[model samples]
Target: MTLPTITVDLLDSKAKQTQKRQLAKSLTKVLSETLGYPDKEITIIFKST
Candidate 1:
C-alpha cells in the first residue's frame, strides 16, 4: 500500500518544537484511525514560515 504524505504548514514561525511534535502525533493518530493507515508508514512533514 502506498502511504499518504501529510504536510502541515504553519504560518507562525514562533511555534515551539514540543507543540509541533504534539501536532504531528495527534495528526498521525487521527489519520491512522480514520484512514486505516499504519502509524509507522504515515509521513508527516511540518514547515514553518
Candidate 2:
C-alpha cells in the first residue's frame, strides 16, 4: 500500500532551518507511532508561501 504525502505550507511565516528539521522529525515520529506507518515510508514536504 502507498501512503499519502504530507505537505506543510507556511504562509508568510519565517522559521529557521533547525526548527523545520525538528518539526519534521517530531511529526514523523508522532505520525508513525500513532498511524502505524514506518518512518522510512513517511514523506514530509515543507513549502514556503
Candidate 3:
C-alpha cells in the first residue's frame, strides 16, 4: 500500500547511525498509533533539513 509523506525537521546533532535507526523505528511506532497503520507496512523517509 502507498502511504503519505512523513517529514521531520530537527537540528543536526551528534546522532549516530544506530541511534538514528532507533529513532526511525520509534517514529514508526508512533506513526502506527497516530496514523492507524502498522510499522511494517509504512514506508518512511527520514530527512534532516
Candidate 4:
C-alpha cells in the first residue's frame, strides 16, 4: 500500500536558483528516505515567490 504524494512549499527569498535547486534536491532525498520511500523516486518542486 502507498500513501498519497506529499508537497513541500519552500521559497528562496534571497537564494539563487542553483542554490534553491540544490536545497530542494537534498531536502527531497532526505524526506523520501525518512518517509520510507526511495530517494530516486522522490519528487521536489522548487519555487521562488
lDDT of each: 0.89, 0.90, 0.74, 0.66
Model 3 compared with the native: what TM-score? 0.61
After superposing candidate 3, which stretches have Cα over 4 Å from the reference? none
Residue 43, model 3: lDDT of 63
* Candidate 1 CA-lDDT value: 0.89
Number of backbone clashes in candidate 2: 0
Number of colliding residue pairs in each model:
0, 0, 0, 0
**Please, what is the TM-score per model?**
0.86, 0.88, 0.61, 0.52
lDDT of 2 by residue, 1-49 (tens): 8884689999986899999999999999999989999898999999999
Residues 1-49, candidate 3: write the lDDT tens digits: 5775566555776777788788888888888999898777766665665
Cα-based lDDT at residue 40, candidate 4: 63
Q: Point out where model 4 deviates above 4 Å.
A: 1-12
Q: Residue-wise lDDT of candidate 1 within 1-49, one digit each (tens)?
A: 6787899888867889998899889999999999998899989999877
For model 3, give the 10-residue run with minimal summed lDDT: 4-13
Candidate 4 C-alpha RMSD relative to the actual structure: 3.1
Model 1 misplaced regions, further than 4 Å? none
Worst 10 residues of 1 by lDDT: 1-10
Q: Rank the candidates by lDDT, best first.
A: 2, 1, 3, 4
- Residue 22 Cα positional deviation in candidate 4, in Å, after optimal superposition: 1.7
